[model samples]
Target: MADELKRRLVHASGSGLVALYLLADYLAIGLTWQYFRYLMIVLSVGVIVLEILRLRVGLEWWLYEKLTREYEQDQFAGYGYYMLSMTAVVLVFRPEIALPAMLMLALGDPISGAVSDDSLKRVKGPKVLVTMFVVSAALAAPFLSHAPLAILAAALGATVADGVTIRIREFVVDDNLTIPIYAAVLAWLVLEFVPI
Candidate 1:
């Protein structure tokens, strides 16, 4: 029971980062895109420095241990990937594509992660997919002109990305990074080709 509670807290805490992403999206409308790029760069550098200090000097030892995955103790944590991926999406894609994609990652991935088991025993589990689709679609509705189809495509892509775990040797790619990129690409394709 305690373990379950701890897990929920940790996952929920991670999900809280979504608020920051959403804030960025909101700010993007008013600020120049270049401002976002610079902000991301500063954030990335700050996170990297803090992470290095934490690992090397044992800074904020208790908080770090509590928040970090066991596998990430010796490596950069999910936060790094989150920032990197968010930056990539903002920089690589147009604002229209980037915002929905970030929203899919920010909202949908967390909903799926909180509820679903980590195992791939069930390929593209229904619960996670459905939750992701609903959350992504709802969050994306206001921003997107053709909300239904574009949001559906983004949701589907996010679900697939979240469901699959990619690894290169010892490094496991976090869903935070993959979900937005996949969703953005898929959403963009749908928006471009399909007359919705």
Candidate 2:
């Protein structure tokens, strides 16, 4: 029962934060306190760094290990940090469409990796990418009718960005630097041509 509780908490917190971010964004509450969100992001990163140090010192486990572990300790810590980081960016930057898409990437990717059990269970390459495209589209849909297209583009962009960064950082770089940047660029493009 303890294990069951842990699993439920991990899943709940992991998915819950993303859902909250979406809710806040759709309700337009995030934009009102955007700076607070960035502050939260900064705080979240500091926490991750501190935790990383703790894990290194044997007081706790590394964030990535916790994220990938079957147990909840690592996931709870990792997810808590992720939620803060994501909420921070969404609030500060107003990356409405990209907010959910990126969270989907952050939350969903690790979950997928964990759930894809067995050495023989190979997720098809294109199918996996396509699945992400669909998922991204669905998540981004409420923001606008063109949200799916934006998400598809972002997913591909994210894939390429992930490939480029895989060996670069020993710890997670701010998605403020990654996913939000993509969202910013997309938002910029969307805003660029409108008659002012």
Candidate 3:
């Protein structure tokens, strides 16, 4: 159990580092990339402070542990897929999209997972799907280009990705590796096909 906890902390920290980079880029872009040098200085200092706090107070492990605990197996699979997908799409085109989308993917899904679990107590299937769809659509709308379509597709993709991974994890390989790669590929294909 201790080892598992330690492992989860390391994993969460890796995700957090990625998120930090993405967030810094997002802030810089939102600020039109001007004064990025100053922004970087401020953010770097902040990160160092946070890192010191984490070491001195165990803040990093505590937060990661809580996040890992709140996440169900299905939620973990879903989140893993979401990150991998967003990473790939952003790597190819519209790198700007990555910072916002990946940040949301990292933060939003977990929040929704916890909230939806309680809100829908005993509910299952398409009902849960619709709830996530609506929430994701609303959250994603203001951030993406084709707001409605992108949100709907992403929500649906998340739904299917979670449901399938939950059902198949026992009989097959980990969905964490498969789902995100597929999603990224799908996003890439869409980008290629779209007129843009």
Candidate 4:
């Protein structure tokens, strides 16, 4: 019970990272996309460097052990992938698609993780999928109401990407990276084909 509570707390705490996406989107509204892109690049690079140093120096082991998966210790942590993928999604997609996709990733993924018991399961259960969709739709509705199909597709893609863990050899692709990218791609496709 104690371990379960600890896991829940740790998972829930990841929702705080959503602030980074919100701040970036707010800045993108006021500043140029190029400015936001450059800022994200710099921040991602800094995080990568810090992570490398942390691994080398064995710094913050307790935090990493608590927050990261066993496979992540030898590779970049999820936070590094989060920053890198956020930057990539912003650079690859337009503001309309990118913002909502990032928002779904930032908020929905953590909610799903916190609520679901996927420790023994590989795929998300119906409860997890429903929670993820509802949360993502609620958060995305205001911004994406005009593009309902696109938003729904993006939300579903984000939730699925978050629920599945993809491994490529020694590296595990964190959902922090997959969720936004998948959501953005699906949303873009919907906008392109559906005439929305």
Q: Compare the candidates by TM-score and give the number of the best one.
A: 4
Please give the lDDT score for candidate 2. Answer: 0.47
> Over the stretch 40-120, how does candidate 2's per-residue lDDT look in tens digits?
577577767666655565455443443434543343354444455455446545556446544555544443334333232
| Residue-by-residue lDDT tens digits, candidate 3, 1-196 | 4644454344344346344554765656443333333443454455556555544665555544444433432233323433445445444435333333443344334433444443322233665556545654454455555544554455455445433434344443333333333333434445556544
The TM-score, computed over Cα atoms with residue i paired to residue i, of candidate 1 is: 0.77
Candidate 3 error regions (>4 Å): 1-93, 115-124, 146-148, 166-187, 194-196
Question: RMSD for each model, in Å, please?
Answer: 3.8, 6.5, 9.2, 3.6
Cα lDDT, model 2, residue 32: 38
Better of 1 and 3 by TM-score: 1
Compared with the true structure, model 4 gives a TM-score of: 0.79
Deviating ranges (above 4 Å) for candidate 1:
1-30, 55-60, 120-124
Q: All candidates' TM-scores? A: 0.77, 0.55, 0.45, 0.79
Residue lDDT tens for model 4, 68-98: 7666777777778777877888889877777
Clashes of 2: 2
Show the lowest summed lDDT stretch of 10 residues, model 1.
10-19
Task: Provide the lowest-lDDT 10-residue window in model 3.
Answer: 72-81
- By TM-score, rank the candidates, best first: 4, 1, 2, 3
Residue 174 displacement in candidate 2 (angstroms)? 11
Better of 2 and 4 by lDDT: 4
Give the 10-residue window scoring lowest on summed lDDT in candidate 2.
115-124
Please give, for residues 1-196, the per-residue lDDT of candidate 1 as tens digits.
3444464465445334435555766756544667766776787788789888977887776766566667778777876777678778777877777877776765667667677776644255788778887787776676675557887787778877887677779666788778889888888888889987
Query: lDDT of each structure?
Result: 0.71, 0.47, 0.44, 0.74
